[model samples]
Target: MKKEKEIKPPIITDIQAIFDRARQAAIRSVDFERVMMYWQIGRRIIEEEQGGEQRAIYGERLIPYISEQLMPTLGSIFSTRNLIYIRQFYRTFPIANALRSQLSWTHYRSLSAISSIEKREFYLSETIKNNWTARQMERQINSHLFERLLSSTDKETLLSVARNEKQPADPKDIVKDPMILEFLGLKPESSYYEKDLETALITHLQEFMLELGNGYSFVARQKRIHLDGDDFFIDLVFYNRLLQCFVIVELKTHKLTHQDIGQLQMYVNYYDRIEKLPHEMPTVGILLCLEKNDTVVKFSLPENANIFASKYQLYLPTADQLQSELQKELSKQNVQ
Candidate 1:
């Protein structure tokens, strides 16, 4: 007698793979091409209603009546709020060819909230090209990315700046002086030790990583290192995917000193000699301190040093202070 064949159990990984592919395909489908479609629809609706006249009552009573009727047939999809959004979307993005497919409806909705047309356009273009999810888009917007780029570079250089896919070539590019750590909920004037700051950073690691810039992956905290029967603990360790290197960060709650820099260098050397992969770049060390002397830092490292020192603030710096500093930098660049 032939034996009955045994059935294999379904694998969760395989099921998840299928689900992910289906989800991606659905997102890519034009079943509801989001804001772009709505904008076009609204534009067409307006044009037909106008019949080539500029003085048509497009917004007054007509839009409300049409929206009311459309809502019943369209369900919640065509509510008055969405209809208004469609109209505003068209108004915001008058150039049809300029609309990007990668941006979801939510992205467009957020973009529409920005008052400045130039700022909105910058975000729209960058978000689409970068394939940024709605949350990423929102974060960038909140970070004032467009304004920051504009302050740093000219309009012609903006696209290149936005398209940067890796860690900045210069330390200045990645470094945000007085790096904000308000998310950690620590007060600047509060009596805090290095361990306290490190703990806070660990607690808010996700936000810290984003604020740190692209490609930073948490490796270990209070990472232990042994050498010649001695034990040492590095404050935090991370790997930057874009930089392709191990990054060792040493935290200091007070003014940075040559000692801090030297310790960081030792950590960097250790990682380079042992932890770093052969294919990866040399390990980079960052001295995150409350204060730094630029002159001392320049002299402490080699001519083209991979090691860097940056100041970290427990609270958010005033917008005015940041703006003024940016303005000064822009002016100097202009002069050069």
Candidate 2:
């Protein structure tokens, strides 16, 4: 009998891979060069309109005229607002070398909204170094992450804290108490089914994930697990890259109890044993409940337990409430 002929796999040469990479690099270089040219042109236009004087009247009118003239030639990219942004961009980052190549023009536009030069520079450096996407950048800014960190630590310490490779050293660093879920649309006193809550959370999943903390990416919602002929469904599961562990979140609309903690612990144990990589950290369990007994939580879990319980809010907490709670916590810590 004749043997079947073997099919050969297509060859991928190293030279071809190098050439492809070179082409991509060249495209990016050209695009960035164009952006830089536009920025410089905007700067020059602003300068000339000022008649080499900072207080010239033409400064106010020049952008509109230039935009009108250039719109047809430059297409939609040369809108008045975009041209103004380019001018602002040049003013914000005077040195081309200071501009981050990794960030797109849109990223620079967002950074330009920040008024403080030092704060803007810090955000720009962190965003570039951390490879934060535009959405992440916005979330960080909206959360007032820089100010929050600064309030708690010095600048050098804050940078170290922000860039630390380890999981958060303190509970305050990782947990956002009274998480905002305004998208749920259900009042705190209103009755809602588990499905309704889950649906709402899914609808506002991005905001939820941001509130959850850094490194958390959604894995599944209402994820079902079966073992020993029994069925168990976890409300939510997220993988935290920084912690290198599975973060299991259980949602409860009522007050938390010891049983709820136990159930979450079991789920965390399951993930730690079965799903976690060999080098990964222990799985963390968070119970997002309407109410939590701090005393019960302190006693229920081992001193070093990775499990946590945080309260959630339907709307943003009043500023006074947050301040009062923070002051209380600080007082207690100081006493301790």
Candidate 3:
């Protein structure tokens, strides 16, 4: 008969980790129950305030009466203002099952402050998508992150460009859009070339990635490949962590044609087949050109293709110009 060895307890880190998770789950359960209770209370109060027939009852005045009834026994959670917010929460989310379990009562309270249904939904979606804390969500709302991110070529990113200009880097820079380089050195004007544009983009790569979207990072420039004794080069390559895909960007000085689209599709196929891992999504290609023909693009690619052809501009338009263009675009859309 052999004596069994004693089994020791888990380490402190493991114990603490388990404890933390349990504590978080308990908090979440409590918070969810609290929110449900408030919503139900608000609903009942509203029902009581509204008379059974067309005649009115206490209406909004029942708020104070309910608060008075609950304050002594239920505590200060039943204040007039808080009751109003709770009622709004129920009305805003009529479907009881739609409440987000991950969010706490505080998150819902913060979201309830938003007036526009569309804007509120956008924030709610973004907040959950980003897994932001209440403070982070509030900060984003205050920063107008939605508006800033939606705006084309927002100026916030230029701060880095301004800093980079006062101090030159190790590498020699290329002059794109003669206008930009001229602004930098008063150099002689030259034709705007795609190569120059690509070179300039590298210097402002951070800004370019930001404009592209959240989670996009620069991967490579002039990414090269060899296939069947022929070599091909991609202008710009980016990886979006959120989208889990490689984004291939091509710069074209001329209007986009079916041939260019076919070329992009070929590159996308190359990436999807070779560069993408089993867990990664398929590659995406974007053709940024001076002009794009919608018909050519529609006819060139398969319906399921991820390649996109869009117009690009070297210069930033003024606010008024952008507004007027937006209005015209909206009008055209309405007409269509």
Using lDDT, give the best candidate's number.
2
The order of the candidates by TM-score, greatest first, is 1, 2, 3
Task: Please give, for residues 302-325, the per-residue lDDT of candidate 3 as tens digits.
Answer: 886788876655444455664565
Reference-based TM-score of each model: 0.63, 0.59, 0.45
**Candidate 3: what lDDT?**
0.69
Using TM-score as the measure, the top candidate is: 1
Q: How does candidate 1 score on lDDT?
A: 0.75
By TM-score, the better pick of 2 and 3 is 2
Clashes of 1: 0
Which scores higher on TM-score, 1 or 3? Answer: 1
Q: What C-alpha lDDT, on a 0 to 100 scale, does residue 113 get in candidate 1?
A: 84
- Report model 2's TM-score to 2 decimal places: 0.59
Each candidate's lDDT (Cα)? 0.75, 0.76, 0.69
Better structure of 1 and 3 per lDDT: 1
- Candidate 1 lDDT for residue 11: 89
